[model samples]
Target: MSKFKKKAEVKQEIPTSSMPDVVFMLLFFFMVTTEMRKSSIEVKQQIPKAAQLRKLERKTLVANLYIGQPTEAKFGTEEKIQANDAFISTEDIIRWVNEEKSKLAEAEREQLTIAIKGDKDAKRGIIADVETELRKGNARKVLYTAADNSNARKN
Candidate 1:
């Protein structure tokens, strides 16, 4: 009998046999769990054109207040304020702001930005009223949105 026995063979390769299955599972998880953040605009939004403008750095912190004429004939031709998807009065703004704040995380609540997007033809008086209500809500951080003068896409 030999003094030393033969050593058993050890495999040095990594197993990637389940890589495709794992990848597909992850892809499917994201596709099903993610919700799109687009808001349907029932009001016409022909945003004003500006000579100089800056873009919002963090869009996640913004709560938009859109001012435009209602598309539906029942709403009349007067400029209307749209928060989220509903038409609301100036008196409703404070409550709306609070609601928007509640939806944010604790750290993000203080950094909330109010974006007022009024159409070019929209009256200034209506916009001013919205601002007043926003102030009552203790929301001072504001942004007036406009489109680039030379942009091909108009919104």
Candidate 2:
């Protein structure tokens, strides 16, 4: 071949040896940053204020029960009990508690604490009904979640 003769050159391609590393890095980034919501709150609530406030020892062993006015007009303004994402009747609190407990390990079940988060404007009768249901469920521990007085209640 003459020194001046043109010749076909090999095509240069991007190296993919690092593609897996990049993909895995992205996967780990999302896994670490993404927060998966376990339940949605459909009620309007302002947790009551308390003189004393303490955090739970084991958050994993707690069942949350919410009592507040429905955010939707269709659900009416009456305070409705919410277990997980749906509105539940006071009579169903026992069942709801059992369902929540079932999600934990056997040892954690006994230590399960029923956390009642209620609206400050909610009626005491409804809360009393919830207490009755909790009694029916035989909940060993119950915690009434309230914000410290230092934290002003939202209007």
Candidate 3:
């Protein structure tokens, strides 16, 4: 009777093999749905033609500079930085550039770059002013992006 009772007992617990599959599925779902960072402002500028531009493998950091019509001042002017008492200045551009440069590794410092976004209607003087400020802030490697053209075959 004891031997028969022992044979009838059943062991019950969660299996281990399926746990890894569940974890992997969760990770894959998040990866596929992750959102990419985008510029808060848009530009309508014509990107200068470059014959020797090489594709970058990755972007470590980015500082956005919006060049367009001067911003309107409001009643809460004291709380914010204003430009020329009528427009918002490009003062923060340098600071942001420096912040991005600081994130580079010792060996990758030379590879740091800053992308400039300028509106089509924006004056060349504004762009030049922004460029001068960037140069003063030690950002020499600048790349200007253009609208995407999609008429090529996919490899």
Top TM-score model? 2
Candidate 3 clash total? Answer: 0
Give the count of colliding residue pairs in each prediction. Answer: 0, 0, 0
Q: Positional deviation of 136 in candidate 3, in angstroms?
A: 1.3
**Model 1, residue 23: displacement in angstroms?**
23
Q: Give stretches of model 3 more than 4 Å off.
A: 1-39, 42-54, 70-88, 148-155
Candidates in descending TM-score order: 2, 1, 3
- Per-candidate TM-score against the hidden true structure: 0.70, 0.72, 0.50
Q: Write the per-residue lDDT of candidate 2 for residues 15-102, one digit (tens) a residue.
A: 9999999999999999999879788888877998886777899878888888889888999988999888889998888888888889
Q: For residues 16-95, write the lDDT of model 1, one tens digit per residue.
A: 99999999999999999987857787778888877567778898889999899998889899989999988999999999
Tens digit of lDDT per residue, candidate 3, span 1-155?
A: 99998877967777989999999999999989986644333223344443444555575644445555433343332222222122245676677666667777777766666666555555677677777877888887777654544434222
The lowest-lDDT stretch of 10 consecutive residues in candidate 3 is 77-86
Q: How far is 16's C-alpha from truth in model 1 (Å)?
A: 34
Q: Worst 10-residue stretch by lDDT in candidate 2? A: 2-11
Stretches of candidate 2 off by over 4 Å are: 1-35, 150-155
- TM-score (C-alpha) between model 3 and the true structure: 0.50
